[model samples]
Target: ADGARGLLAMRQAGARTIAQDEETCVVFGMPREAIELGAAEKVLPIEAIGIEALRMAGEPKEGIGSRGAA
Candidate 1:
């Protein structure tokens, strides 16, 4: 699948990566493949995904809060 392939390619290009755990995945095929291929650095459950991704994305490059009128 494209997700698995992309993960592999990204790893080959020196990028850290994460994948959803098989137990938490609706479609385990992709994540499973990525894990099997040694592309994923860690596999986390869906519930923890948001926080983990946010942490990785880092302290928001842009300023906090909305840009709309106060």
Candidate 2:
């Protein structure tokens, strides 16, 4: 799978990777391959991926600004 290969390469190059869990993926092929290849640092539901990525990047969950702040 090209996607799996890319994810593997990224992981090997010191980039953190996330794979969509089978439960949430409409088609699990790519993510499954990445998971089996040990390329995914974190396997999560689709809804949680972006939040987790932001957390991993040390960015605030509130996003770039305080627009949502009251």
| Model 1 regions more than 4 Å off | 59-70
**Candidate 1 clashing pairs, residues 3+ apart or interchain:** none
Global CA lDDT computed for model 1: 0.81
Estimate the Cα RMSD of every predicted model relative to the unseen true structure: 7.5, 7.8
TM-score, predicted candidate 1 vs. hidden true structure: 0.70
Worst 10 residues of 1 by lDDT: 57-66
lDDT of 2 at 22: 98
Q: In model 1, what lDDT does residue 29 have?
A: 87
Q: Name the lDDT of candidate 2.
A: 0.87
For candidate 1, write residues 1-70 as lDDT tens digits. 7888899999777666789998889889888999999898779999988888788677443344338776
- Show how many residue pairs clash in every candidate, following the order shown: 0, 0
